[model samples]
Target chain A: MPRVDVELPSVLTGLLGVPRVVPVEASCLADALRELSELHPTIDVHLFDETGGFREHVLCFHNETNTRWLDGTDVALADGDRITIMQAVSGG
Target chain B: MGTTAVIGTAKGGFILRSDDRRTWSVEGPLFKGWKLTTTSRTPAGTYLAATASDVYGTAVHRSRDLAEWEQVETGPAWPAAAEGGGNGEARKLKQIWTFGHGGNRTYAGVDDAGLFASDDDGVSWTPVDGLNEHSTRSGWFPGAGGLCAHAVLVDPADPKRLWCGISAVGVFRSDDGGASWTPKNEGIPIVIEDKSCKDIGRCVHGMVADPKDANTIYRREHVGVFRTRDGGEHWERIEHGLPSWFGFPIVMDVPTNTLFLAPLESDEYRMPVDGRLSVYRSRDGGDSWEDASAGLPAEHAYVGVLRGAMAADQDGGVYLGTTGGQVYVSSDGADSWQTLPVTLPRVLSVEVYPS
Candidate 1:
């Protein structure tokens, strides 16, 4: 398993008190997200809908590139990579 | 030693504390950027709030002290198999509008207009199929606000007997513990006025059930204020002395047997009458009303109160917040008022727990 760092959005940490940066060991983004959910179970609902899909305002970045633009969350990952979770640009 | 209020707003939520209802201290703008939609204190003493944003969608948070909050993993949601396959045109759990607790059961009335029950004190939820899938559901629509089941009232004497208020869809009564439901809009006016489906189309802004008698229920509707003594079987207009018929946020102070409501000028503008905000109180049910905004602004206060923005604490203190982000309280049972000395984004809901 690769040890990756996940940077959470302030929108989540401000509400749930979860750390902004979480280090988890996983080989793929899918496993990393599962680990994140396991570590901070509360953030799961804020990140994904009940149907297990990303919430409307949630966006994921593998280092600098958006994970959404990648083939899928199952793509392999190496140790020391950074994953950024963010809220989409939403305002009237 | 005093009261702690959870004030929910469009931008965030605030926890206001006052040793005396006179002098106050404040906490939060917490839940920082999330739109705090509704707040509730369960009978078991858990503080709960629902938040929504264009980014992360809607989620429920629970707290013991209103300081640290936890988001519930399984809040109210429409199953992909039963309705819209995740935000479908017909059904989507847009927001949790209100929470009603009866015994160990906590019910959440939500947008997309559905009822969900939490047996373990808001930890998880299960949809109430009877009311959510009513036969006339196909005709259920939204008012100026979105389609939402915003109010749920449980009979104090009989928890099984419940009433739910859904915007643009009339009131519903469940006599068999939510196993079945029936429309109870006898004399209430309709918003969309769809004659084909007589049971729906009522835009009920807010509602309160008499603590003394579960049979009596009062609702501030789109057109006017109404009261029903026969448990929603029949209703009558209670606007005898009220300046206008339209309003939101109806609450009852059980100890004083008083009803408090904030009436806007009309549905067209949705602001105070002549830029003056007033909270009306009805002492004898809803026969007549009197202005209770003596200490509030006299004029130039063009504000509106949302449906869940007014609440009554256990000690009979009445609290209300406004679209202008002002919160007022009357310890003497709505006879007078005083501003809390703090303001924020448009106030959406206010819930107080006395210590």
Candidate 2:
């Protein structure tokens, strides 16, 4: 099993109850997100749209690369890999 | 009772507290970075704020102390695209414009032109299927502001009697609670010239029902101001002395038969008439209008007030926010005005709560 760290923004900290960084044991990015969602059910609505697709304003990065531009959420994760979730600061 | 003003803006919401009408202290930018469309305090003292993120959809937040807030899980949402009768229209909840309270029930008028109801204190919401799934939903075209159900009125005399105003779709009234509805634009002016959709194309910019008499309602439309003596069954033009016929906001002092409107130049130039900022006040139930600009700017003031940006307190205080990021208050029934010290993001709504 690979242990990956997830970083959440300040806006979600109160709802999710997790610090800026939390480690979860998962073998792939998709599984790690699932684990995160299970721990924080309220956050799932903000992260995904009605069609189960990633929200347009949400950006997920697998280490330094944007996960959206990558192949898919099925990319394998490795020990010590970091995942960051952020909201795009575009609209009012 | 202490007074608190809730100002919703493009970036977030602000709460201004005042013990005396002379001075005030501001506290916010709450829900930072989100567009707050409206805020209302239920009779039970619970405050609900309608907020939206361009990406995360619309949400309803509730609070009791005005400090700690919790987002409601079951907010207004459109039917999934796949189940939307194959019209292929992308149904999204763009904004929540107004909130109406009746007994223990709460109603919300939202963009995409639909109504929603909540029973458990704003914690959850269910679409009013009668309005959302109306047979004429397909013919309800979007106006300049998009298809937005911006005003919802629940008759205090009869909770079963409800009225909702949607831009370019006219007004709809339901005598059987939320189970059924009928279009109520018999005397409203149709701005769109299409003969086929003449009856349903009246653009209602803002509407308010008399607090003392639910049967008497007034509305500011795309062409002019109108008043309905028989609920919304019949409307008559009331823009007799107004500087301009086009405007967005209408606030009323129900007990005094006083009304306030911020009229723009016209549909083409949606700014103050003649670049002069003035609020037209009708003290005789729209029978006559007067420029209530005693203290407001008189020169080169080009600002636009949105539909929900003006509000009136029970104590005769009138407040309005402009697109230019300015908020003005008039303590003497709109006869005089004073600008607030702070300037914020484009203001969307103004609400007053008396403690």
RMSD (CA, Å), candidate 1 to true, equals 2.2
DockQ of 1: 0.60
Q: B1-355 in candidate 2: lDDT tens per residue? A: 5789999998888888888766889999887877889999886889999887676667788999888888776787776561331134667677898999887889999887889999888888998999888876766777888788999898987888899998878899999888999889888767654445455777899988886788889988887889998988899988888889898889887667789888899999999988888898988888899988888888898988988899998777889898888989888898789888989899999999877
For candidate 2, what is the DockQ? 0.44
For model 2, fnat equals: 0.29
TM-score of each: 0.94, 0.93
**Candidate 1 chain B TM?**
0.96
Lowest-scoring 10 consecutive residues by lDDT in candidate 2 chain B? B79-88
How many angstroms is residue B110 displaced in model 1 relative to the true structure, after the best TM-score fit? 1.1
Report the number of the highest-DockQ candidate: 1
Error of 2 at B309 (Å): 0.9
- Give residue B218's error in model 2 in angstroms: 0.5
Let me know the TM-score candidate 2 reaches against the reference structure: 0.93
